[model samples]
Target: MAKVDAPAVEERQKGILGWIEKTGNKLPDPVIIFAYLIGILIVVSVITDWMGVSVEHPVRVNEDGSPVVEPARMLFRSELIEHLLVRMPTIFTSFHPLGYVLVVMLGAGVAERAGLFGTAMRAAVRNAPRFLLTPAVALVAMLANLAADAAYVVLIPLAGVIYAAAGRHPIAGITAAFAGVSGGFSANLFPGQLDALLFGITEAAVGSLVTDWVMNIAGNWYFIAVMTIFYLPVIWFVTDGIIEKRLGKWTGGAVAGSSDADDDPDAPLTAGQKKGLAHAGLAVLAVVFLWLFLTVDLVELVSFGAVSVWGGNPPLLNPDPALEVTQQLIPFFTSLVAGFLILFLAAGVAYGMAAGTIKTHRDTVEMMAGGMKDMGYYLVLAFAAAYFVEMFNLSNLGIISAVNGANAIQQSGLPLPIVLGLIVLFAGVLNLFVGSASAKWAFMAPILVPMLMLLGISPEMATAAYRVGDSATNIITPLMVYFPLVLVFARRWVPDFGIGSLTAAMLPYSIWLLITGIIMTIAWVYLGLPLGPGAEVGYTLPGAN
Candidate 1:
């Protein structure tokens, strides 16, 4: 294969990218797209329901002992209409990421509004050496997945600010941060809620075939650690070498200045500001210690009383000697979003008090409210997205498509590696529509997991492959919940930046990450490397002939 110069490739692709930008920008806003999707889903559901399109349930059994299959249900009918109209409020409220985002923002808003977040981020970036700035931001963004959405909310914008402050193209910083946060999403050094969620489905899939099989949530721990290391340079090279060069220089007006220091980028940190930072640091440590005391088993004897007061031992992560440290702290891992809430809350309060940003208790409360206020558009978008997703599920279109896709692959006489690559590619295509990784996996696992196991691939490998595809396409997809939000962040710096511009900027990351992920997946499979702590690249379904 001929090596393509980044600049030449970018130049050659300009026409196509410009077309995408023109077309995408001309389309309605994300919320409108979702609302339109809801309508389309209703129409399609009626058509499919009338046409009697359906698929046999992959894992479920019927009461009469036959396979339980799902058929398309019309969303326009009386029952479905009643659910949509009457329970509309509940539909929005029960959206999975809604609560997480709201809870986290209650704290993040305080920090951001109180000026704690900006000061801290600026200080951190200002102190970093020139050469390490790009990689440092990328690495931090990769690890920021532990904070879930906060990474996108905080790090991506800060990256642009940092890069602009350092005299580079601010968009490059945004791209790098986004690449790590979204593109390398699953490639973390540690497992968190994502591990638990996907592996739970993996467990159910395994149980369908191997009755006695057990799942360790840390199944992809080692693989992701290696993936993180492998991806670091990819982001580094792309950001510093390719992206920055292509963008030329930072002539996009003044960088976003400090929110609190009279809009000055180089304003000296006041004595009060320094003190606030120190107090914020201490607050972070205190919150960490508090969570550790409550969650870690070693302190159960002394802290059990306090832990019980807060509703006591979590269901997933109790002191089970048989579990890995990560598995044992499943409760902690899952509660990270809330943990971040308290973390930012306390730190923000401490910093605000010392920095005089919070002159009164009412000020702190107002800041928290301000955070939610910032999320107003997000709430509206989520409501539409939630209904669309729920309706799609109700229509059974997602599953039917997934099953048919899997069946097609199973019947093809393709090589195993090639089949897996196609699966990854298919997932990338599907991700353009379904942004929720877990939701897509929930529908696909029953088919892909079992199908791959029969083909000598492990559920861990299947999940891993799914993750690679899911993450690689995230940056480019408009339907992704945070995609518009990230664009909002970008527009703050460059007022003219549109969804198309954001999509075009992110396309490079998506392509390179997808290529790297495919190579990594194939290499890992060919070498037969362990996918996780106790998981292998191959599986033997119990009693399979």
Candidate 2:
């Protein structure tokens, strides 16, 4: 290694990043690109239709056993592409990224940026026993996805602080959180916009292949719940045994300088504040009790039969209980509002007692306003992202590519395991270019879901497989919208660290999980366990396949 002064090293690093930044800045975001991609897909569909390359299924098998729904020709000619493109605007815009992030996240922003998230996280870390850091972080990371950006933006930085406070390298904490947030992206009990969006595409895809194909939002909920448990130990071992000690203090990536806040010694909570918290706790329990009492299921209270957990037809997006059921405190996006309300009350009482600033509604409103103050930049980003996603999906080019490619995979007659592996790999590869899970899945589900069903795979299982690959590679993809923000965090801790270094550091996680998830999937299929309520591993039925 060349021994250069820090100044020269800094300048050289800047030059490299400056170049990369310039190139990246010129690149359209995934939303815009997806729009263009959707357009291309539309063009192909038109071409294929004009060329008469599509297959038509009669009520009976016409000539070949090759089902019209699963025909290989979907990808072959250009017209199928046009059909894909034309239909994209409706689908993509509905799941538009701007709308995608904002609807659920407004309350998230309120809860987090208002200092509730930060204070709570710091408190948890500060109070956590040493043995609990790894699992705690892993759990928080997965749950943080509930707030989407809050998890990445707030939790990642806090991880560094938490790790450093524990006498470990801050980077390790950051990495663990990053792994949880990005790597565990698909594993959540509650449905978010992403879950709803992906389910729609998978449903469309599966329906195209089967006469009775359906997909629900809780498709992977049970398996992911298991994964949360499975991964907690893995993260705990890796962090405590490998990451912490290897993460020596104040190294290249550990936080230095004045910016590090976790270094501050914890101030004692006031006796009054503690008392206030007792009040808040009782209030929260009361609210929860009332909520539970109101929502007692018909199956429990009467003989009206089971309540529709999925909320009805189109089970994945609908709250219809007919399809699937999994645990969640509130309905997907709406829960954010409910959560923030509780947090606001809880935190407000604590703050009031400690600071002696509040006794009325005015004070509470001010606290909320403070939260809103922190949200300016994100709202702009959200609006821009929304427009970008909407436009890109209109393009349809990406859709054609996914549809065509998936068609090829279906006809290959590869063993189920092999096909799953290939899909995982394919997902990883595509991730290099695309970062939005729903957008990519929107492109893929219509093609892959149906094909998998033809081969006796369930839509739920296929969605889970796709989730694994999509999530595993998130850490490695520079194209991810938040990738730059993460680099900024890394550089805070390791000022000398470059973008490449951060990516390289994260690669171990991405690679390891990719392999682990594949093995898990094979095992899951072998067990023939329902992926979730109404979700199965094997073929639909003897006659169906």
Candidate 3:
């Protein structure tokens, strides 16, 4: 291995890529950024309170039918201190994404630790045709959200090895997988932890206007499923057409810090691992059948009386027939978080047992505990984010700002599609600064959701647009938590790979993904497509008409 000159690499970086790297490096940690924003929010709240700033509420009105006005309340008072000190624990615990992410991680961690996720990803791309390699890796990367953070650790470097085996640039392999994983973060074939996390925040934000709204973890299912489909070609085209051409070709050489025996891309799974995968597959099917049984009507036979019983309208189904079907399935929709937990836990334990990774019940418990340990930083960040969101709500600044912003946007005469597109752009720019999708949405949703609702947009649509922006720019930003890890992965093959190198390699995917995502978002709204099962593109406030 050779040592590369750092200054030379920095000097080589010029133009937009250089600027982004420089600016992104200057930003502080996201937790600290929220703390700073909280300080600024306090100052703004006091100044607005003193100025008597207020906005006419879009939905709420007085007894005489006049619009109700909301004013910014001061946050520097004693009550603020009390809420901060006394209610701190409650605020943190009640934070929407806190429980949802942690619960899903518990099961996902076990699966990853049991080697199920890694084995699945390797199996997916192991024997791909040379031409189909990019899409295979891209597709698996999108689906690899089930593995959580393990996707970054296992699939990415494995992708590089796979590509090199196929005589393609290893860095291009890393780029495609990185784009699909981080850049396609929200795009998935099925609802997973992200859906739970974001929709939980959406429920909290929309609570100001609609108190009874439930967070359906699968609210953005259809949209993100389409996103996975749309992103596949973009990643394939960029990786195969553009990036690979630029990298020229790979020369047979030893990968940095990896022996040939360890880095072999064609290594076959052991007999035990194969059996474990079969067991995991059976566990997945069993869980699915259980959920279906709970949600759908089924018939059962009673041996004693030789009679048949129809198990109709189970607990997950609504008894009333008059309501819309989506309304009837609310219980089923809300159960997806627990569904993911059960599915992963069952599959992990089954795989572990068959593969000899879990010799006893205690091993599963340790894996779950390990999952929570990884979330320590997220818990700390969530504490700050919780305070920021609650404090913004307490000062009345969130609603006031939302109402006024909605009013401005409504009066601007801009088309709804254009506004949604701008949201995609805005979120992309912000992604370069704040990388955590949940953290950024925690602060933005309270304002964006209601503001859009006032303008007749659905919370699901607002969330969808945010997802498009948040994911597209993930690969370009140095601020993304996994950006450094990705650089290290690339450097394992090409030690000269730096922040600029990775960013440059991934920029095409970023640009195309952003462009296509924005277009898709606008088109979905224009076409009036449902964002999910029962989630709509437009919303009307109850009683507003």
Q: Against the true structure, whose TM-score is highest?
A: 3
266 Cα displacement, candidate 1 (Å) = 6.3
Give me the displacement of residue 257 in model 2, in angstroms.
2.9
Question: Candidate 3 regions off by >4 Å?
Answer: 1-12, 61-67, 253-257, 260-262, 300-312
**Candidate 1 residue-wise lDDT, 497-539, digit = tens:** 6666777778888888889888888888888998875678887
Evaluated against the true structure, the overall lDDT of model 3 is: 0.87
Model 3: per-residue lDDT, tens digit, 1-58?
A: 2343443545346887677777878988889988999999999998999999987766
TM-score of each: 0.68, 0.69, 0.95
Better of 1 and 2 by TM-score: 2
Give residue 166's lDDT in candidate 3 (0 to 100): 81
Lowest lDDT sum, 10 consecutive residues, model 2, at 1-10
Model 1 pairs whose backbones collide: 57-69, 219-532
Model 2: how far residue 232 lies from native, Å: 2.7
lDDT of 3 at 491: 76
Alpha carbon RMSD to native, model 2: 7.6
Give candidate 1's error at residue 404 in angstroms: 2.8
lDDT of 2: 0.59
lDDT of 1: 0.74
